[model samples]
Target chain A: ATERPEALLLVMPTDHAIPDVDAFRAAVAAGVPRAVAGQIVTFGVRPDRPETGYGWIEVRGAPVDGVAQRVERFVEKPELARAEAMLAEGRYLWNAGIFLVSAKTLVAAVTAHAPDLIEPVGEAVAEARGDLDFLRLSEGPWSGVRDISIDFAVMEKAANIEVIPLGTAWSDLGDWNAVWRENGGGIVTQGAVTAIDCEGSLLRSEVGGQHVVGIGLQDLVVVAMPDAVLVADRARSQDVKTAVAQLKAKAVRQAEVFPRDHRPWGWFETLALADRFQVKRIVVKPGAALSLQSHVHRAEHWIVVSGTAQVTVGEDVKLLTENQSVYVPLGAVHRLANPGKVPVVLIEVQTGAYLGEDDIIRYEDIYARGDEQGPKR
Target chain B: ATERPEALLLVMPTDHAIPDVDAFRAAVAAGVPRAVAGQIVTFGVRPDRPETGYGWIEVRGAPVDGVAQRVERFVEKPELARAEAMLAEGRYLWNAGIFLVSAKTLVAAVTAHAPDLIEPVGEAVAEARGDLDFLRLSEGPWSGVRDISIDFAVMEKAANIEVIPLGTAWSDLGDWNAVWRENGGGIVTQGAVTAIDCEGSLLRSEVGGQHVVGIGLQDLVVVAMPDAVLVADRARSQDVKTAVAQLKAKAVRQAEVFPRDHRPWGWFETLALADRFQVKRIVVKPGAALSLQSHVHRAEHWIVVSGTAQVTVGEDVKLLTENQSVYVPLGAVHRLANPGKVPVVLIEVQTGAYLGEDDIIRYEDIYARGDEQGPKR
Candidate 1:
């Protein structure tokens, strides 16, 4: 009780699905006392199936709700046979990698185990800058920080590690199969999907107009986005990483970038692009303004499809309403702003010799991005 | 042999793939004499695999080159076991549905059997009209004719049907699996696709820039188009028909229509569409002209991305080249024509209260479609 502290920190992966918030809160509250007492606490979920895709954690004794248990050992994701055996043993739980610990204890564990990582990571945080909202770490120090999970660097080597049995359904959702499993198991259909005679499949289309069809298929995952589609055997969902690497090696833009580019104010999607022209659907939040910019090699036509837009071309400033348009000739300085209560939606047609996003030259920006030229637009 | 006539009619399915032209010509040449001698000749290919998706012909005698054999019973697409057994039997051949027969004999045979079809079909031919390069059959009579295949309507009932062995590579391309087979099997890929640790799979993206990723997939078919994505078991390729029918029942447009709308001139593909806006990339064939028309509900902005376009807006007629654009206001009679030797490619952005294809009122059309507006352009 002498090591007990007043504050404790809980670490969880943001992308994981833990739908029962109250149950999760109760489990975290249960672990907090042990964590404050200088015992690094991990949470474990009872397994319902012999899932070979997740790490299994063995407990020393019977697990009780709201009670921390002594850790036996950590096991990596096992083969089907091993997973079945572990499931039959009745003491193994899914290692969800959730952790509860005091800040001092985590720091001490990291320093004791991965001593080499402490300096660069600490420097990165020390030199971080507040960019409007986000605290961006220093690039130079961050680049030197080794890319590793806390479990491999600290939990696996710590001596005072303990686990609390979480009384809620949880899933890491590490891959598409996990997503399929999280959607209640039998033929998960999401967004513009039709399944005929399909079982244990995930047929998903991310966009509204893109329909996904599955026929006479078993245990498959088909995910369709605007620019890319992924089809994989549900059992082999983890192997999608290698396919992504192959796409990256071939310089496919979809490997690293999404079709919709999000910005501080709103977002824009390239509807169509070709050699000398590009069409974009842009939405600007109310009171948001794009940087005063112009392209040397392109002329743009902006049509206000919805809401109101305050448009500026050269020295002329005009308010364009729905179904109104303006043409910005090549080299003309222009700016588009949503000065109304609603978001401004516009269709922009760019005609140019080179229509790359890098062709922009910003003269002024209200969002504090003045001269920096990137693909943010 | 007196059944032979001086003229022969060879019928083949246009959708079939017969890559060996010389071999096909030789086989046709061999069957020509037999067909001219008043025999109804049907071509059969040697079975290469246990294909359950195609009809099988049981031949009594060993096949010889340029020789005809007496007709045997026609077996429909069989189960896997029957297909495998037939594949093992050396006397079985794939009934390709190609037929060679004399016109007089076919008409006489058709008159003898299936007597009800002759009147409606003959009336449809009698009332046919020439529209450009296509012979337009009278819909009244054509609709009265039963939707039946030649095999079921005539060939199966005809006692004079004889089989001719054709030594040529062929494929009906009945479904995605047949496309995979045509593409040379074992991990067939088309367009932008990346595969990792995959075997016996067909991963295809119908349009460029749409990348398809397949990982650890086996015996599967994945096809991604602009409007729809289909993932199915390779052996269940034929069942895609049921999926399509289900889509049709659900009133999915992709089930019946393609994304690209083809006109007599060229084609246009819709890049994006919203409630009141539509963007299309249109390519007009050289020397082709859209109808002199006006839309009451929508206005259009046409940006010439490539080649040259002769534009007509009211009394103003201008030739716009690459990187140039023109605006056609609502209720203004406008026309777009490709007067240059090369095709004209343009991006059309429409903004309106109602942007339906039926909103057009045409004055004149060089393609001879006048006074009848049923969604041509």
Candidate 2:
């Protein structure tokens, strides 16, 4: 409802690599006049290949000013031979999903073609709540809206649609191969990666102190994380989702979570896990506090390595600075807070017969997650 | 000298993979009698392929009792065509280097062919010093001896020679391919390894918590260690030594040393190393003690996690059990000893401007290595 221009630009999520920004901008400018005149203008790219992944736009005639043309029809992804025939016909363009329309025109089109979506979306937007800096939509109205794209809802059936063709180097970086291609081919390596006799491969190590060695590899992708690793053929990079699915089916925690747990206070990572003891490097953000909690089965030894920590153990409270340490006996209710302007980093060593995170009983939590256990912090 | 049988056996480093111990033992037993009769008998294996990697032993005649035969000569590794011809002729066997001879006969052979070696070797053995239970050879005479193998010094020119063909499954295990063959085929993996569409490959990870993933890899070798990794084609596995040589030329510590340093007392591994700080997990065997030492630039905090430690700090001596810790300030002489039957395991956190092992000066050491630094323990 704020004061602005009458028209709006809707950029749909069509994964693309647009190399010629000037040409793209010029093409969009050509459609701005038409859009302002109440026409919905969709930008398209000249089909260099018979791509089976993108939809096509058929123009009614050649562009009036060699920039924009009237739209004849919108077509779904076509078969390879039919796509080639359309390409030979020289009237089809690959849909890039870039749209420009007047706000009133878009509302009119949606009201005419898809009346069922407006009420729920409007209600969801009206009932949205402010969460910190994010606006959270009302779940009831949002979930009630039908799951459909704008193409099926209004764009395909709208009259007064115009099409503009853009010629530029574009690619959809949908997989590792696409990324490799975007990187200008050859071996793409990062971190502690050593590649010998490797071509058209991507080898990356995201974990510190981890090394990846690739030898005589062609068209392959290797990604090494701290807690998990992935190796996939370059052509089969899209199938990496299958690995995620398999890991999820197996109920592996690494499938959906990382070794370092992020929290409102800060972050902590388990350095080592053993049968009777566990070691973690905990970092608390400035002016952040942890829950007042106690563990029945564990005793903790905290060594402050950086900044300052205000620790409360039992009825005693003390501030520990760098190079100092404190011990918390078993069952002692303790809390750690960073009160300084810098982060407080400490090494926490927990020893017990049963050191499961479920052994904790939270008394108070500022983040309102007292019932959450096992790495909520 | 002690009174015993005169005959002796010498097992050269053949790098063999003998599958049938009974058959090998019987083959050696057959040669024992001939060796006792003063003939220098060398066991050979019948050629199964035209292997160009091993030397060939020519037999003078067929095995008298399907076991032992007179040896004609030993030939060096031949060209592929020559090896094929020899394999087809059926009179040659691979030189297994398994020798059985009477001690007096071996002495006579050495006297005849390598006269200069016997005197120096004998003097070196005679002047060997008894170090604990190990006999340390006198460096003076040992260094003066010629660097020649027994084959070139004696067996190649000996007057009395014999060969016993051993028809058993044996592999030299000279490379990864040989190891893969010995492992009975496709995708041999150890530790935490996941293979997807991999064939005829060897993937091994020696470090705990390390995982190796292979995808669509054919005839490749991947070995992951704590501090280094190696990946090579299976056919080029022998060239892994070349990689080691290159690493050595670059003066990489991982080329020759492992992350865990072993000592006479026990072992210790660096858990983490950072600027001006280091963490080590040290294990001390029962009845073992570290040298009384002091570091000019470092302070140490030792936390005993297992067993008991007898710690001496300056003038005070204290016994610390599990869950107890002690701090040694910089320049304070200290010693740690394991007095319990089990090993004393402790986490040592070192903090200093200079945390190098060379920063320490030892006052007293029961192992008699006071001047040694850098993990001599």
Index of the highest-DockQ prediction: 1
Model 2 DockQ, alpha carbons vs. true complex: 0.31
What TM-score does structure 2 among the candidates reach? Answer: 0.76
The TM-score leader among the candidates is: 1
Please list the C-alpha lDDT of all candidates, in the order they appear.
Answer: 0.85, 0.78
DockQ of every candidate structure: 0.57, 0.31
lDDT of 1 by residue, A56-153 (tens): 88888777778889888888889999999988888988888889888788878888999999899889888776554467677789998899988788
Q: Candidate 1, which CAPRI tier?
A: medium
TM-score of 1: 0.86
- Local accuracy of candidate 2 as per-residue lDDT tens digits, B1-377: 12444847666565678989888788788888888898998878877899887889988665433377777878888999999998998889888877888888888898899999989988998988654335767778999999998999998999789888766766787776778778887889887677777888888867565556666777877777666566667877766676666667766556767777876678887766655567778899899888898989888878777889999999999998776778888899999999889999887777777876678788898776664335454
Per-residue lDDT of B121 in model 2: 89
| DockQ score for model 1 | 0.57
Model 2, A1-377: lDDT tens digits are: 22444847666555678988898788778888888898998888777788765789998765333377778888898898988988888888888887888888887888899999889988998988653335767778999999999999998998888888776666777677778878878999887777777788898877555566676777888777666666667877766666666667766666677778877789887666666767777899998899899988888878777799999999999999876778888899999999999999887777778876678888998766674335454
